[model samples]
Target chain A: MPTAIEQELRPVAPSKLSLRHVSKIFRGQSGETLAIDDISLDVSEGEFVCLAGPSGCGKSTILNLIAGLEELTSGEALLDGAPITGPGRDRMVMFQEAALFPWLDALGNVLFGLKLKPNLNNAERREVARFYLRLVGLEKQENANIHELSGGMRQRVALARSLAPNPRILLMDEPFSALDTLTRETLYRDLQSIFSKRRKTIVFVTHNIREAVCLGDRIVLLSSHPGRVREIFTVNLPRPRDINDAAVATFAHQITETLTQYLETPATKEAVL
Target chain B: MKRNLLTLLTFAAVLAALEVAGRNGAWDTRVLPLPSEVAAYIADAFTDGARRDQLPAAVTANATAATLGTATSTTAASLWTAFAGSTLTEALLVTLKRLVSGYLIGFLAGIPLGLLTARFNFFRETFGLVALGMQGLPSVCWVPLALIWFRPTENAILFVVVMGTVWSLMLATEHGVRTVPPLYVRAARTMGSRGLHLWWRVLLPAALPAVIGGMKQSWAFAWRSLMAAEIYVTILTGCGLGWLLHNGREVLRMDQVMGVMLIIVIVGLTADRILFAPAENRIRARWGLDKN
Candidate 1:
């Protein structure tokens, strides 16, 4: 841990968000089930960090906790040393479902996000919305209804909506997992470029190993059965890294080996004891 | 277009069959008049000199006698002139006024209550369930209560109309608000929309299709209730189409009775086509719920 003064003086800080000993337990009629057990991680500013794990790993739960969409059972999630209270304009989320309001057109949906900015007048808000629509390659489909757009286009509109607010942190939970392989590949390309240009502090959650390796600066691997941080791998690969690249494959292979080790070893069965 | 043509063709065929039946006395002419004669009667009812010639003095005497002192004691010619001329139009206008006012009052009260009931558990368990129960009760069942409360006045008719409609509107609104996807609400909240703003932007738009559907149903209920109140209650208000339909039957003028029935059917169809259908189609189209 660095002192407050030291943290301020540092040219490039290590963390934009810090989670300390966070745990989540869900209570049901059957009894209590520990979803996450004392997980801690730091995500730096302008860094794309992926919380990658198998199903039931509480990866999505962690994203929700950081989003302030859910209350933590214990511990804290801090944004710039301040505890996240609730959903705010400072942190925008793109859900797995595009979740665009069907009643609004693409431009209207993006403009809705711009409503968070009190400074912009109607005209200025519209201009900002149009700019984001263009950025997401949806300039032509601004007036199109959600059902009229392709699944990929709907996600693009959702991306534009999330970006229009210019939130400091973007939380995405398996946003592209529903799209086809080709559509997901195209999105990966666009997302990388967008990340480069916008430099937003993004926390992406995914179960795909290659997706995590392709987009994240640092990947935090979580193991299931009371999800705990199994490992953290920093990808030293350059920007615009392809999912099919050999370097990504090497890193993915290494992460998979560790994950396999955890699955095979009975020593880690200390989980109950 | 082809479907509409088919509908028109079927209607024309029915009218032709009715004309044949009426000419050959297949059934008593008094039982169901010739469709052509009913159409002609309706047309003549609107024309001044033509209606005066067509309305017989014997029919007028019979109308006044059947209801006794309840029918105003004007001379046959004067009564026919008044009934066919200004009275018919005046009746339509008065009925329209009552329907619109009652429907509007129900709409104004029901929508907010529904939204509130859907959002709050207390409201849902109380007013929401009560409203659903009220909808199951027949619209005419409120007529007796309305008559006792307001007596023989315009307010009585208005009260019945409101009672007939408000519960359905409330239930529709509650259902609409309740069924709005949680995804949209969550998404809106994350975008910094809270409280009333959240309801206005996300919840209202998401619930609009169902709300409009409810409004259409309320209008139908209000219209039906207005007709029933006008016919049953001896109110000291202006006569409406229902009064005319009652009078037409009393005089044993089957053609006149059928003409009024045609008008009622036409008015209802016109309102549905002009007001509700286009609005529903527009909502469906904009929301991408329109498959076509």
Candidate 2:
């Protein structure tokens, strides 16, 4: 109700981010392949949107486009009403692979993200990097080598790195898919806590339906093979929704049923979880 | 601990068998000298006043003085007598200085060239083709050109050493940059890394493993080329291990030849273990590129 009141008050506010009729075609030796087609989306400031679908749904491709890693074949990607021509620290990306530089320790890896920040001296940068590491519950492990950290810990370090730049938007591409179930659940709770504290607009890509239900303010369901917007589901469930909560399951079931109407693939069957 | 013991035991067994063969006359001592005799020759290097002396090579009037105007036989004579009175250790120092200097130059020059070769088509078509083509030529083949251009001075030796190693360094660096994981690059790019920052922070580190591999091979080539240069173009008053080996051969002293060969093998292994192994291990461990 407060969010509704806030939205009503800011009725004329421009969208924080928008993808206007975006399309992408990849040309390989096999010839032209349409990656995604005519996908339009608008994400308000501080909103958590999840793009969910099966493999080859171009969920990652869309994230890549938003991150300015890939060029769109057609249409516009705008941020705060301005066209996004390239990548910047304002929209940082977290890949599935933590992608930490091996030569650096955990703190050093986070510091690397702050290399472009010209104002801060070396000491200030270390302090900032340390602060972010503390935020991710990795303060004790800052000196740990990249390979020494667990897979979950590695992602946590990556999350700290992406956050350290203080980006306006965070693009995460299945950042937790490779983690174990328990780790994913724990990260969900931690993420929700972090999301509440630092209200950055987030676009998360995932194949996990319940995960989408738990984390997203709105889930943007995508269809595969030249990905298109299938539907959008809003989760009005209360704050810090647990993945195993009965309400979360009901919402997940509801979304799966909607997906079943269009997709009979094995991916829809996977949507139940 | 156990593996090291096994290696030592195996080596001793080989040495023992060779010693027995020499006593039984399995092969002529002239062609294949006795292991014991070779050991004696090495010991002789320690005790012989002339062998142990680090004095400057005797520049007698009769000794062949090599200038560019002379023939190959005269050059061979100059090389043979270059370290006749000086200690083998002095020759060793000369070889090592050339090897270190050449490898260092190649490293400094090759990194940027390799990066350029990988990134730009301009370099790939021009320098890249040259590097690849040069790989086919043996390091010794460059000696003739090096001698003509630099006239058998220290510069000529250094030139041969650089030419021998630079091509491998170039190819390795290019290959290293080209094969860096796309994900790492993409990840860096998304973090607002571009241009020189990206190259220095991401691309260079990612390419390190491959570059290090190239370094190992180039080091071996450096030693090979230094020897070739020392043996062929020895107009310099100072000598290297190659010149020492040539000296032994010219005298037809098989024991001295075998003794110097033993020193070469020991030096080669030491370089690999002492200079390169720890670096390779550290990179592999830190980068998670190890087989574990």
Candidate 3:
């Protein structure tokens, strides 16, 4: 453990979140179920990686492990060479549900995490929160209550709240899944633009193969039932990659084929509904 | 416009019917006094000064006894002695003491217990059920027990009021805590809030509406229990609305009893309408928790 003085003195490093043979087993009243079996992957500094798998395939369990929101049962998760014992400011997770506090308006929700930060006065905190709100294209919606906003708008607020703290690694668990297709597409373009400008390490989880192909530099496919890394496919596509492009389609097909094969296996076939 | 007019018409019709019935002697006067008679009684009490002198003495004795009893019971002190002033002042002091002390005790114990029951399943299983069971028993039922434990003093009445209010509050808090959406907890955990901070920042705010609703119910129960206990219990400590009602009954003054009953209704309704309504509405609107 780094001493507080030493930690303060050390320059902030670009976070490289890594998992080594991580596994999670859930024991319910009925029986013991393995959620994730020995999965190892590395998300390099400023890289966009998507973990793509079918529903209930433990893709979210991987994100949870990386965020240190849940114990790994086995193996280790590290951020910038430091082993993650629990959740910290360095890795922020955004969920499918916006989860913005209903009591707080957009600005207040964004400012919630910023308030916990040290050395910043009230004025500075407000400025920082406003900056992020504007960054997410919600400057005018700052005072709007969470309920007043549409579903897509709520997700945007959640994104602003997560990004306000400027965490080294952004962990999103199917954040855009709840939005309509058109809204999801718009958010994807916006997110891509932000990622291009900010160059933050993002681990995005999604079941949408096209989304994985569009957003991620690399897509890691996980097999269902005791989820493990099935394949790691690198997309050599340009920025603002078109989902309708032949190349993107080919890649999606190849990845989907591999995922389908894994799903068809007798043990997993029954589990992937 | 039509709906408003219809509502006004309905109200007028009811009043007109009541006036007609009273004038025609369709109902027994003693059992259900005419609205005009009640109004006349009120006007006489406030203006004629016929009953004014007796009012002060009754109020003073009741106020002193109530203040001293509750204060002595809670603090193990003789704060009631401070009531040795003018009759009106003593009455005011006694009412203030009972209301504040009883409310504070109920709130302090109830809120924490509510939180505890909400947080821990074991606590909820044991204490939640216990609280629920106790809530079913009227606060007035505790008067005999309070008298036995605290003796024939004002402490007994205070004890009864606290018992009446606390369980409802605790149950409300527990319900609020339980009903907090899982998303909020997950979101708070992601933001590195756990244990105390999680409970304070996320759980508490989310559960506040239910808790406040419970508080309103608790106050209603406390008010009723305090009046009943004061009237029946052997603790001759103070003069409250209940004590006043009791005196009217003893002197066979049905008009005075009706007047005191009117006071209770007015005070209770005022507290709900003026204080609690706006607070609850604001919370409900903010959370988007209200159905209508």
Candidate 4:
């Protein structure tokens, strides 16, 4: 991963979106099950926050609530000041699967977002789409079909599509979990640079501790089985922070240890309590 | 291209063997015409225009029936009347009308029903199994009931066509909707698409290839049913290719029977090759669904 630092870059002022006592329950033939339990967190604008946990920890469930893909059974998820009722154009999501429309080429996928913005003419939509595609270092791959692109390239296209709409907040659900380690690291660096440049508010979800440490300005770790935020860690590490840096290593170790301890805790402990 | 050529070669070899067997008295030549004789008969039918004269009567009747049927059912005047210049034109127009109208009605009803059954749990539970069960019923079985329901009118034929084609389309659409990757829906929802917007933008496009495949299957069904309906039920108005085939059989003119049969096969093949093949190819290619 290549990292570059250039000072004098203006920082985007923070805006906060908060969740208050949010709970989600899913009903099935098996019975009603709690997916998330009284999860509450606040995310500031232009801050890269990662929700890290084990598989089935409802990390994704929380992100979905924020994006309004799922409604909270109890309590509230608020964006800015208003309670989220459903998905809005202001909050976009990127998934582990690129989910690029196969029929559309790379540029077409980006343009699909821009065209949905309302009242943008053909030429303007084209120009805006091109700008974002170029931003993602995919200028030459504009006409390439989804299948023609590599996994990393497809994710880049997905990122460009998500960003092209210029949403107030970006929600990513294990976005790089599908990519190889090397590709994921490279994407992490590129994504960090893009985030710095755009300063868009982002809430990323992942199970990987190293990934969360490398990318998040703040990491929110959730405990599994009726997911609840276990701890929130702030990483004040400066820009171009090295993965090999002792501080980053220590932070990763601390988060992983905490997560492991949470995972190992017995379900019977709750009954005993 | 290579496969098509090989297939043609194989077909020719089989026909040659049959011709040689008939000529050598290995089989009765009277019951089965030699390949050369059939080819010659086909050539004469086209060049001499003997079969062409009989074509007019069949085409004229089918067109008249289709026009009357369309007029009675809907206010929209039939396009068949406009194209009824020659026997060939009339036959082509009537068949085309039946195909378009049947497919259109099937698509309009099937897609929504498919989507509904696919999306809503209640609808899926209630109707999905029923729809799948109905698909197993052969379209030809509908002819007698359709005739009775519409009283052997042009409406009866249209109904048969619609019934024959609709199930495949419905099944295809349902399958398409069910197979749409959940990730796409999540992604679309994240981008603020919901309800009709979600269906139009995400669900419809994702389900399109399957729906199209269903349409092709529906067309084949409609075509087959139309022919069968014409053979059994006397529509009393329309002149269909099936009527021509029946007439040939009635007159005991094997040459005419063979000629009409050739026309039917040629037209069906042409439509499949020219219209549906290109559209399907383009879609498959775009979606990366094609293996070849």
Candidate 5:
């Protein structure tokens, strides 16, 4: 471990987050269950990668591992050439539920994420928090209570909160899954805009193949039950791509078909639904 | 507003009916005094300090105490003075003071105790189990134990009141902290919040609605336990409202008894409305549990 003074003096390099043969096995009351198999993937700096598969695919578990919210059973998950043993400021995870504190207002929730930046004074932090809120199109709802906000609005605030800290890597576990179609579409556009504006490595998890196609620069498909990397699809689409665009739909369809075919094989045959 | 007026009108009509029934001897006035007479008795208790001849002997004797003593006065001199006489107003104030003090101390102390219960296994097995088991017993059961421990001093009443409050508050806090959704903690921790920051900033606020609920219930428990203690340990605890009620019963002053009962109900309602109502409403609104 580097000394505190050495850490401060050394300019931190933005190396890619690398997962080398990472595996996670959960010990429950019933027995030990393997959640993830040996999965080696490197998310480059400022890359938008989506982990896409069915429910039991351990896509979320992958995000948790990357965020250092879960311990690896085997192999190493590295950030900036350092092993990730636990959660830190550089890695922020946004859950499916907005998870915004009901006790706080919209800006208050964003300001809470800003608490990680100890050097920033109250006024500067407020300014930074407000900027992110405006980025997510919630500039006017700064003082609005979390409970007062609609479900879509709440998610927007959660997005703002996660982005406010300006983490090096954003690990999102199906943050928009619970939202309606229209809201999710709007959020996809907003998220794309934010991702481009604030360049950061993002590992997004989603079951929606279309959502993965619309958002991710590269989509990593994983097989269900002891999730392992199935295939990689690189989206060669233009910036700010629309989810309803024909090109996006075609890519989504292709990925879904390939995934279904692999899962339907006799040796590993399993029901998709 | 319309509903409130309807309730007020209904309450007033019931009081008026009771007044007429007692006046006509239909309800036996001696057994249960008219509402107007009870109100008059309460008024007399307040203003009849100078006119010794007209006032009830008990009222004059009690009210004749030099002045209202402080709530925490456990010194021998204060005890002697309190034993001499304590008025209806003094009794009410003393009870209120004990309820507020005992509950505050217990509630504050229980927050950490309850945190222990929810956070660690050893505490959960030992202290949490004790709190859970003790909660099942009625609060009045503490009065005898407190009397044996501290005698008829103010400590005995306060001890009972604290006993009534602490366990309930502890259990409530434990439940609140334990039931906080795991997502909130995960979100905060992933953002680099841990240890005490995690406890106060994330965990405590998340557990607040339940803690507020504990405060409300703890207030009621404290009030009840204080009353029970006052009834038995009546020597120098400044003759609390419970003592006044018991005294009225002994003297067959039905009006005084009902008057004290009315004050007790008023105090309960006032605490609920003034202290808890707005707080509960605000929390409900902020938490998205409110109807409108």
Candidate 6:
């Protein structure tokens, strides 16, 4: 095993996102509701971490907090030792809905991400956009308008757009959940390949256990009703894991069993009640 | 293609029925002239000799006398200019110019005001009620105040037109900006867009469909207001399409009146069909906003 001093002397990975005892409380007419309980998570550089749980678990809330879309009610979310105050291009988010600008075609949508990189001229930007479009296997549909693309194609365009910025951290909020099972499986493979090649710190939020088991290096199970981390499982499965593979299903089943046990626990039971 | 042909046929049928009605004396000639007679009268107004002959005797005398005060007399040498200026086409050009200018001014002012109102709660609370109130108040209602303030000039007409369309434009802009899906804004923000850049890239484009819809409505209001302004303010000058209608009615030239009315209808339809509709369709097609 590599010694701690050897690791310290080694070239550090670029992105290491840390959420230190983060909590979120939303106050409305119904009164104060704890959306996220105190939860701490550390995602090392180039690691694929998935927040997996059922709905109302604040999995998306945590993702949003990490993305700097919403401020933490307590504690801090840090990127490379600095607390995240607001949204930045360094942390690009891919939403479940594909949230693409309808007015922009596929190439245009991808180019939109390059807008932040002011150093690139128009030609350079176009080249970069084309590169990402091809990476997402959407080179042919570059000129196709948002409405012209199917749901899977739209998501691919969105993925291209998010990746075009070449952010240090990619925060995905159930990106493949909206697609059909077949498309989702294909995207799972593509996403795994992209992850291996790109080597970026990614925080993916998904309720699907199989998805989390297949894609994530580590799965962070969040319990519902004032979401808190229930269990953390390190998937020892090999790279480019198939969602339908027995190993993936076994890990998924194990995570699900742990999640159900956590749900049956007194604290979560009372919260649900 | 079939729809357009059907529309043309229906229009021709209406014109034929009207011509037959007039020829059969279903109504007195004084009440309504034959469509062909109106068409001929409009054509004659454009023709050189017939236009020269149509000038009043006193105006003709003034042109020959070359009085110092007769600065704008219809002299024989400048006969076409005078005739053209008074004809439906010339009136149309003047009216369209005013309508476009006034509508543009309102549109420019309205978009910023709408953006401000939509973005800020304070502006929305204060100006929102005023915009709603202005929408209820007709453009014609502003004419009286405009006349007193601008003294029956082009300014007065412009004032009325602006008042007519500005509120609608502002309201449309406000609604458009406000209704931009939170998702798009949030998405833009995550992409490191902020301030004016965000507004230009995300907010403005997001609100375009609504803004265009507003502009179409604004054009209609501005066009109507211009007609009202010309008829009322240019009682003495008789400068535009509205003035032509007023002059025809005053002189009991029923053919000229009918001809001007037809021009007005044509202008209105052309603005909607030829200009606004195509623009709207293009945007809808690009954005996939419209259903097949």
lDDT leader: 6
Q: Per-residue alpha-carbon lDDT of model 4 for B123-211, expressed as tens digits?
A: 88877777778778877788889867889887888888888877778778889989999988887776766788879888888888888
Q: What DockQ, between 0 and 1, does each candidate earn?
A: 0.64, 0.62, 0.62, 0.54, 0.73, 0.69
Better of 2 and 5 by TM-score: 5
Worst-scoring 10-residue span by lDDT in model 2 chain A: A5-14
Candidate 5 interface RMSD after superposing interface residues = 1.1
Candidate 5 lDDT over B1-292, as tens digits, reads 9999999999999999888877887877767888887876665554433344445645553432233233224566645444333355666778888888888889878889998898999999999999999888877888788878888788887888888999999999999999999999999998889999999998888998998899889888888887777776776637778988888787777887888889898999999999998999988888887656
Best by DockQ: 5
Which regions of candidate 2 fall more than 4 Å away from where they truly are? A1-15, A265-273, B20-27, B46-86
True contacts kept of each: 0.74, 0.70, 0.57, 0.60, 0.83, 0.72
What is the fnat score of candidate 3? Answer: 0.57
DockQ, ranked from best to worst: 5, 6, 1, 2, 3, 4
**Local error of candidate 4 at residue A151 (angstroms):** 0.5
Per-residue lDDT for A156 in model 5? 93
TM per model?
Answer: 0.89, 0.88, 0.87, 0.85, 0.90, 0.90
Model 6 agreement with the true structure over A1-273: per-residue lDDT tens digits: 874333322332449999899999999999999999999999999999999887889999998998888988998899999999999888999999999998898999999978678767787788878888999999999999899998999999999888887788899999988899999989999999988887779999988889999999999988888899988999999988998899999888888887777678675565431
**Residue B232 displacement (Å), model 2:** 2.5
Question: What is the C-alpha local distance difference test score of candidate 1?
Answer: 0.83
lDDT of each: 0.83, 0.83, 0.79, 0.76, 0.83, 0.84
lDDT, candidate 5, A164-209, per-residue tens: 7777788888999899999999999989987877777889999889
TM-score of 5: 0.90
Please, what are the lDDT tens digits per residue for candidate 6 over residues B1-292? 9999999999999999999988998999876888887876665444333334567622421122112223234467565554554355556778888988999899888899999999899988898779999989988889999879888788888899999889999999999988999999888989988999889999999999999999999899898888888887764443688887877887777887888888899889988998789989988998987756
Q: What does DockQ come to for candidate 4?
A: 0.54
Q: Kindly list the per-residue Cα lDDT of model 2 for residues A169-263, writing each as its tens digit.
A: 98999999999999989999989998778778999999889999999999999988889999999899998899999999999989888777777
